[model samples]
Target: MGGMARYDALLVVSFGGPEKPEDVMPFLENVVRGRGVPRERLLEVEAHYQGVGGVSPINQQCRDLITALRPEVDLPIYWGNRNWHPFLADTLQKMAADGVTRAAAFITAAYSSYSSCRQYLDDIAQARAKVPGAPEIVRLRHYFDHPGFIAAMIDHTREALDRLPEEDRDHARLVFTAHSIPVSMAASSGPSGGAYEAQLRAAASLVAGDRPWDLVWQSRSGPPQVPWLEPDVCDHLATLHAAGTEAVVLVPIGFVSDHMEVVYDLDTEAAGVARDLGMRLTRAATAGTHPRFVSMVRELLEEPEPLPCAATCCPAPRPRGAS
Candidate 1:
């Protein structure tokens, strides 16, 4: 419980997004660098950012989360992003200059996977390697099924359910969604393998409770020939409609904030799919600045330090076309 004794600061690590049209492509390039993502795919994703004024909600959401966390946590809070301004290396440099010797990192991502868990750790390690005297950064434990997180999600899902027509509310199917990764990544995630999907299903089950629910994937990228998790949200929506499911609530349990994926993929693309199918749909908000969720940060900090993941855990995928 002596968080202050163990760490001098709290570092917020998040997936960054572009703040302007011109920054979109560059940011996307940083995201897919060395990953063999086609330029065409980058351009396609770029348009999604442009459609919303070329601003990603992620950066602003990070700012908002830090703002909310400031009052609850006693230590100085710093933020860093993986692929945009306020990059991780720069943030660590600042932390070093401020005399911060050690810090606890609260990554925006909650689950275990190559991208979600290990990649962020790798980013921190890489960033620290670049900064002289960079503070020792320890990541908070995964909170996919933490009570605070589940409570916030349940409340939001209920709010979304209430938004439906009274007649449809009772029959609305609960559909939990997360970002999709390649099948190889999913299979190899975490220490023993398959931890990514298992953790997600656990969180979804907790959030769904006694309600009938289904887990689906969203925001898939990369070549079509490569396999990723499925059925995709839009595709799943169509199937539900065909099965006479007239209404549904989408709980984006995979994301922590209403970033581009939540706003664009679920709200824009998936919403369109439901509209076309004449199915009622409402999306539960992510746990952005939710009071309970905000308090969870302090709770994580107070807990005993977590064990670091093994090197083999969530190993980075080989680049596309790599033998």
Candidate 2:
């Protein structure tokens, strides 16, 4: 393994989704394990998961991704879920059993937030505690600024815009979205600061430069006492309608695939609001298995060595499994 020696294997880690109805609450409960979201809140979230029959689209997307990415890398690629089956800890155990000495992991999320970025690092840290001679983990550098990814998103955004009615295309307010987290979690998000919004804006700019778009947050959730991002999509849509904004185009630039967030939040929740507002809306396609996306991950895994991380480069904010 020459250049392939960056690691003995490559792991594509992602937020796991429940594949059946009964697993919904348990899966969501795992996600909010440390957050202490009440049973009512968990049930509310589970309600959405159940609406779609409890199957998350992430596993299927990961399956296709692993398939397409095989030719790009020589080592075996393993799929692990952050909150579900073939879990991070279990996957690490299996890799150790399979005699993997050193491995590189690329969490599917492409941000610098606590849960989004460093927690994956923390996951590897926590998992290694129990395993002997665990592979030297090389967390891939963030690629939000990568050219191939930006190009893929750009092309996809243009294509999504084309689907809108002719009259609305020009007037469509461009909306970029990602998963929402507590403001407290967001407070210490960056090795620097505010990289979450910056990376998203950079990605969105690559696709929407001079195209007239507004960056508003979506899917903000909390304990009803604490605050999250304001003017959520529903509020934004109403205000836009009041301003006579007739059409809109949504780009889920924050995500790589049509996970539950897109399917449930946008398709079911936001889409319904737009329909009621009499505003035409279309969402950019999630970059599930785009060639550029696949190639980018391949390039990352193929790098001769890991880039030296600074003291602040994606350091974990809270201890993994701390909750």
Candidate 3:
């Protein structure tokens, strides 16, 4: 019975972050529950959160986006997260209590990957199982190449380039970044494989236009032995600096907000590397609350309802102990 007209609510699903100083460890625990990230590595990630006073700006960003969407769409908006407070299960409970029967889910991540795509699917499935009378959730299609999303990134990329010296602005290399999943996961991302990298490349290419650019990985969490995507952003920056490049613009095409990964990893760590290298580096803003992006959400809802991904699409990565 569910078609385009069957949805009763809109859900903005996101990768949640801690909002206070005390929620760091628990939030990190939720993030790395399984998958065997070592203790030292977990502590290091915890430090990244603690360094920022234990607050990740992601939750607030989600709230801001929803607030912006409230007026544009008629459906009641429900927010949920995969990692932190306002968990998906809790949100679904609220939705069921509110008598919502069906909802359209708009995940924050644009590209495809295990963590970005399938993991969220699994989260939705688990949450629905936990909450009785939970609404059927239809996830919106991936908008990596959506015109509105591209426009927002283009605007931000231009703004970031303008921040560089005029002499270097025109020649600044566009360095696009995305989260680094394990090599195995990256290889098996889509129905066939390699959808994660392929989508990122497509997005980066659109954002670059005539400008020279490279796609790089960041915030890799697995063990050192496990190979993930190649050419880490920071390392790529160093490579550019070594090659006599004068300036660069970092576009975070993979994410929709300036969460810990964008703030700490790019702004703090990578920017520090650029400063030491004397390379003028400016990071582009994400699509958070960008007018075009907000409009895009409304547009997605109006379009023909997106068909669900195949069960075989974006399969979960191989477990750590599996041979």
Top-lDDT structure, candidate number: 1
Residues 66-150, candidate 3, lDDT per residue (tens digit)? Answer: 9999988888999999998799999999999999998999999998888999999999999999999999999999999999899
Give per-residue lDDT, candidate 3, residue 76: 91
Which is better, 2 or 3, measured by lDDT? 3
Point to the candidate with the largest TM-score: 1
lDDT of 1 at 91: 96
TM-score of every prediction relative to native: 0.98, 0.92, 0.97
- Deviating ranges (above 4 Å) for candidate 3: 1-4
Clashing pairs in 1: none
Q: In order, what lDDT does every prediction score? A: 0.93, 0.79, 0.91
Worst 10 residues of 2 by lDDT: 313-322
Model 1 segments more than 4 A misplaced: 321-323
lDDT, candidate 1, 1-323, per-residue tens: 46657999999999999998999999998998887787888888999999989999999999999999989999999999999989999999999999999999999999989899999999999999999999999999999989999899989999999999999988899999999999999999988999899999999999888989999999998778889999999999999998999999999999999999899999999999999999999999999999999999999998999999889999999876779
